[model samples]
Target: MNAPAIPMIFSAHRRTLRLTRARHRSAGSDAARFIAEDMIEDTLERLAFLRHEPARALVLGDSTGTLVASLREQGAAVEEPAALDLEAPHPSGGYELIVVFGLLDAVNDLPGALIHLRNALAPGGLVMTHFVGGQSLPALRAAMFAAEPDRPAARIHPLVDPRAAPGLLQRAGWKDPVVDTHTLTVRYASLDRLVADLRDQGLGNALAKPAAPLGKTALARARAAFAARADADGKTAETFEIITLTGRRSLAGT
Candidate 1:
């Protein structure tokens, strides 16, 4: 798995495992798929503005092919990125619409990855992406920080900043890029369940050098501390800051 330039993110190959698991164990089934589905539907709607059906479409980081299946159901041809070489240059323009979801946060070389995606698109083609980033899990982060203050090597999963989206796209030769964000809050019956869900979701803390595995004493301490911060209803709050991005490359220009 390629390490992303951004610290603490999962590797590309491992992301599928994470998302698939997350999707499966998602406590709020509806909310779990909300972001991914919303991104796909929105991207499709935007591509409709182009006034023609794209003959070739590419879907990046399409683990389990939910989006790919949707596109195929729409009668569009789809190519998935997880099966390709992340370092390879994008193939000559063949796709008119390219949608990458939940991947930017994990790829080791985001700019390089975007450039490849850009190269695969036909002139004037559009590329849309949604990724987990930008202070998405502040509460969880805060708890971790409180649990271990001196663990600088400890890293949680890395997320992209919405503010960095435009620059990243530009560096990849994507013009007229637009990036925005939204927040999602998820709940857990208990701090323990929440942590379990995170692990099942493949969002296991990937800190560069996390503290020693949580033994019974440490685990109890962390849990008690987390519960102390729980809301009146007794549910722990988890935030996910999602970033939505869109960009285009001129015909034969990129």
Candidate 2:
């Protein structure tokens, strides 16, 4: 499985995902561990251009305190983020903005989750959900197949395509739905470093039934296959595609 793909049609058990994300809460810096934080900040900056700033904000799935702090620094009264269920709508509905930092891909019910987010917002509020998508890390995926050429179990989640997001947003009753994608290319020295970076990003296995780790022989083959893709500089390139979905809760309930 490529490190950059998001779990779109995922059989991810919610408990497993929660457990995986919990590690970040007690851990130190999340820098470079994942790419969503930086993208979230960028999206916020874009929002600022539209004169959009939250008076009462809620940030879901924030691994670090930085985003929460940033909201407060901007004078928004923000509710501290947690590993809350996206399908379950919050009873309170006065938030001017809601940001889902890194958990939308693995959700069990994408439309239901979006609806819950919409319902949790006050009229004219905005919700922005970010995740990884598009064709990411083809080399890594090929290497994984080389690891178990015959019977490779599923490990990576197939993230939702950004192209389909606008329709989904409309189905969920989001007004002026917007969906966009950004790409980042990173070079790595070895697969080990790549795997480490993934774990650091709180991207451990969240599958309902995760495949067992590859045996030593299979791992060796995987390493060799991965190494074969290295460039002249002895580094391999990986692509990360970030998808952002933004919409407004309609005042007229459209």
- Assess every candidate by TM-score: 0.79, 0.88
Candidate 1 global lDDT: 0.68
lDDT of 1 by residue, 1-254 (tens): 98645543434446555665655555454333555555666666666775546668877655435768867877888776444545567654578888876656666667788888788778888778877786877766666665665553355766677777878888888878888787778876666666665554445553334457655755566677677778899887888787888888887756
Winner by TM-score: 2
Off by over 4 Å in 1: 1-13, 16-32, 48-52, 91-93, 196-212
State the C-alpha lDDT per candidate: 0.68, 0.75
Error of 2 at 73 (Å): 1.0
124-188 per-residue lDDT for model 2 (tens digits): 99888887775766767888899999999787766678888888899999988888888878898
- Window of ten residues with lowest summed lDDT in model 1: 201-210
Q: How well does model 2 score by local distance difference test?
A: 0.75
Among residues 3 or more apart in sequence or in different chains, the pairs in candidate 2 whose N, CA or C atoms overlap within 3 Å are none
